[model samples]
Target: MDDYEAIRSGILETFERAVDAAGRDGAEATRRSLAEARDILAADRLRPVVLGEFKAGKSSLLNALLDDTGEPPLLPEAEEIATSVAASVSYGDQETIEILRDTDDGTPGLRVDRRGLREHGTEHGNPENRRGVLSVHIRTPSPLLRPGLTLVDTPGLGGPYLGHNAATLAALPGADAVMLVLDSSQPVLRSHLETVRRAASAVSATDTPGALFFVLTKTDLGGYGEVLADTRAKLAGALGRPAAEITVVPVSARAHRDFLAHGDEEDRAAGNLAGLTDALWAALCHRGVPRVLGGALDSLDRGVRALLAPLEGQTEALEDGTRRTVGELRRRALEHQARLAELRKGRAQRRVALRRRIDTVQEELRRDAEERHARIWDRFESHYLEEDAYLTDPQRLVAQLTADAAQVVGEINARAGTATAAVLVRTAAETGLAMGSSRPTEMAAPTSGDLVVRGRLGEKHRSGRLKRRLRDLSFGGSMGTTTGALIGSVVPGLGTAVGAAVGGLVGMAAGWASAGRDLRNEDRRLDRSSLRTQLQPLKRRQAAHISASVKDICEEFREQAEQEMEERIEQEREANQRLVAALKDTEDLTTATAGTRLAELRERTRPLQELRTRTAELEARTQAFTAAAVDRTAGGGAAGARKPEPVTVPGAAGDISWAEDRT
Candidate 1:
């Protein structure tokens, strides 16, 4: 355990108590938030995945890390996808291997894997992972494992397993850290660099910093020094990070294995494996844990603030008394209601106009998306298909095509997101007119959820079978987008809260990337013409699906907007009635209970005030933990030219024995 993890553990314990107290106080929302906070902090593992091109020694690096005690490598290493299956190695009381496979009912089940992993999880047996093997869990006694660290071995990118690309990309955001392994003997290609950028971009979008590391593997092969320098230079040019801040380390997994087995200092010195191990442990202790803890703290703080709001509002209402007569208030309500009725009539006419205009917008969006596909495919044919070698090599063809397809989907999703926002802005203008306001402002600043809608779409599709019934779909009904759910409880006001709801619809229309998965490699030997001929049907089907889905989503948004308008009007009417009644009854109540309501409100808020104060203290601790972790990593105490110090585990009496890098 790192200091951050220890602090998080303390926070979790305190938050659990807070949940109990809140439940007792009947603060249901605060209790729910605190319970969620407990869940987030209960998991102790840091999942730092190893990702890269096929045959980059990713598995070997992970095996070396897992077998640090001179044990045999736990994972099978081969040059094919047959040995890759997104294996995660963690600590266990008893050594065990659990294979998580999807059942016929589509839910995952764990089966003991005593024989081998290849039969259930390899590409040859479960090709394209279509056999339903989700993940492999390996348990070991390595001291590194004692800190609750899980090393994930992802399938190689740009391999024959196209689905692996989607799976890996989807998993990137949840990773505590990512190690992008590269073959140091070769120059870093554009694709490899792009892989790093994508991972960094995803992490940064979530506001998590320093989650990416570059690993230059196969150092024993020689001539890697020049390659390492060049790769760093390119990364600096590409990512705009200070070269010093970007941690790129070199290692040889074979040499590390040799050193561990025989205690060969020469092998250890040559591989620098000890240095890599220390760096990894230090990062887990110093960077990963603090960042995660900080995020959780931010979430908890927001929940507490939300709880405090209503109490404060009620207290303030009691303090002020600009009471108006009940009759006057009722008249004002009727005037507002009449204006709302006129607005509704205007909205109905506008809806008809917008509905007609929507078809034109959809057609324009579809045309734009198809043109993007045409451009990408044109490039693919001109560059890749023109080469006889690309056609002959199945792996090469599959990898290139998979990359091209994902790129096209990503680009189209972006365009669709933009177009969807435009449709929404146009639709909202009518609502704005009804409310006697100017043009509506934009929704909450677009989260990564807005830009990468397909990521969420793919997650939703993978979680269940999305039936074709538009009304039955969550997006089609009232659930709104993922962005909407995040704000549904926190933000107040009709326009502000539901603006996020409308944004969710925009996300759904734009981010439907699950369709790209329909492209497969049943027969990988097809030439360019045959491939294009084969894909034409999928393209046509996908285009039609997009059109229908977008249509349904837009229709749903219109309904939600109308429903929101009505709900807002009703809320205003009801609130005014309550105010009128309160004013009419106030004279009698003041004689009997002056200041009584204010006293009760203050008493009710005492516990909440205490929780808020405690939350502030936890926030300070979270910041301190982050700052301390950053300082440790920055001073060459973690990873740099100097031999990295062994990261001390929290809650331990002394250091476990892998303190010095034998290198």
Candidate 2:
């Protein structure tokens, strides 16, 4: 067995033992922890979603990759937009189709015949998915899926149906990797580049590098060498990465299917199916598998810690030889209750302080945004007044302005996010709570559609008079908005403001000289004078919107931090209550009853010790496996450099000499 399989088996065995021990000893909390660990392990799969525009051959690629050559293909393909609902293909003992639907009552999955998939999954049959199909799950005994890798075929983006785009975008977050399929014949449009950027951002958000792959389909039709090269360049530019860093695989699913039927070597070579498979495997091994394993190990560690908590508590209680009266136990319980009250009061006071800190941070963000906008406006005015080229070329002027606006918004958002994170970190430190990694919301960059420039300008002309007058005139400055805020900042409800503010600036600049109107015309000399008058309203609106978003972001961070702190406090309160209850139960026990309780506690010693040992072993094995996976993924060593030792679970009745003898 591979390291993952071996380690997983060991972990499962340890969990089973923990569940049994917890059940026998009535450790409900530990049992719940084990159950959660099981659920995490069961749900862990390497999912690579296939995404593309409509009719880009996504379903065909999945079929070819899985080598589905039965009487009917596993995933149906048609001339029109076929897939309406996302379909996930995974490993199963037999071929089965489960139609997952959302009804007025509740979401339910119904097993359906293979023929019924078209009725639910295809656009022609479903017609904007009126059937309310959430997703379709297909299972087959395919070797490609046997490695715990699920392939998701999502509805194409930029289709006539808006639901298709939503469905495709919704599948992005859950994907470990994204295979962005593009048609070799079609030119890469702005929408396609937007999709690429979204996919890149999603993968980065998951912290999985080298997980996005570009697949250019339809190679069997004709020459697509240039198309492939151009697509690579565009994708690289969109991601702001080098062209060599992007992985593009050109394949013809039709050719691969033909090769499956004819067993021709040339057809197989032409298909390049094997190459794509290898690339995907390499990505999974290097990025996807390691991430999944790391998460599993972390979950297992938490479960083990939960199991250890109660065991340690019981050991401490049993080791205590103090003979206390009922009054003494009640007095101790009162102290715990007092402590709980103190914790509650501290929590309330901390919340008030957190709000104040958030308010301070929000105000600082507002000032920062205002200052940045002022600088940006200064730059814009300089560009407009100093550059003679901007006077003649309206498009270039708008482009430069939009680029500057995007950069400023990004910088402002980044600063706001950093400030908010600092507040959360400081709060957690004061409260002594463990804080998770803060994932700041990112705003997408503005696209061409977001900025609309109206009216046409006249031909290029170098007007010394216009430039001299513009330089002499005092130019007032205003901030503009981008379609989306910077990478780390931007909140909802700001998109319209972004488009209107930024697009309005471009529109005003483009229409300043009038359609086909000469800039040298003395009649339009005052047109340049009205630029500041027109920009004032847009600048005020943009400033207001940006400030509102910054406040919202700060509030969001504050609430998240407060919620985590409250949860941690509540957990401690519950644990203390449980301890008080146990003490009260002991307080009522007579001398004979107390002896019996001690005997029972001694009886639990063996099983708890066994559980503790098993859990430690499981953790050790998982750590070793994770380290090996990481090493292999990083090319630091060979896969066969070391072999994992077999894990042996000790029997319940095994000797516990290492455990302190309390008998």
Candidate 1 residue 531 Cα shift, in angstroms, is 3.4
Clashing pairs in 1: 1-650
- lDDT for every model? 0.56, 0.61
What's the true lDDT of residue 377 in model 2?
Answer: 66
Best by TM-score: 1
Model 2: colliding residue pairs: 410-486
lDDT of 1: 0.56
For residues 1-663, could you state the per-residue lDDT of candidate 2 as single tens digits? 155556566666666776676566455654664566566666778888899988788878888999889755778775546554678889888999998888877657778766687777787667767887878999998877875788988877766554355456656655667789999979999879977976775565434446677788999988888888888889878988777656788899999999999999989988988777755654454345544554444434444444444334533554464544444544665675686577578877888998999799778877866886676568657546344454444344444444444444555554555466567657655654434223345433222234333223343344674664443231210212232233114555556656555554554454443432544554234333444444445456556666767766777777777775665455445444555666666656676776777677667556656656665665566445444443343342111112212222121112111111010
Per-residue alpha-carbon lDDT of candidate 1 for residues 1-663, written as tens digits (9 for 90 to 100): 355446666667667656775576555644665676568666756878778887788877877766644323466566446433477888877677788776787657565553456566567656656666767887877766665678777778856555466556545655667778888877788778778777775455334335566788999998876787788888877777666666677888889888887889999887776567655644443346644454455445544544454455445555664343434544564565566567666766766766665566557756765675466467666765665556555344444444444444443343444354455446545453211111112111111111111111112233223443232344433444556656655666645457566756765554333222222221222345565654455445445554555455555544654554454344333433434444444434562373886687688678768866776676566555444444444564223322223432111011111121111
**Root-mean-square deviation per candidate:** 24.1, 16.4
Q: Which portions of model 2 miss their true places by more than 4 Å?
A: 1-10, 22-27, 44-46, 78-80, 98-111, 128-134, 146-149, 158-163, 184-191, 206-209, 218-231, 250-252, 255-278, 281-296, 306-345, 350-663
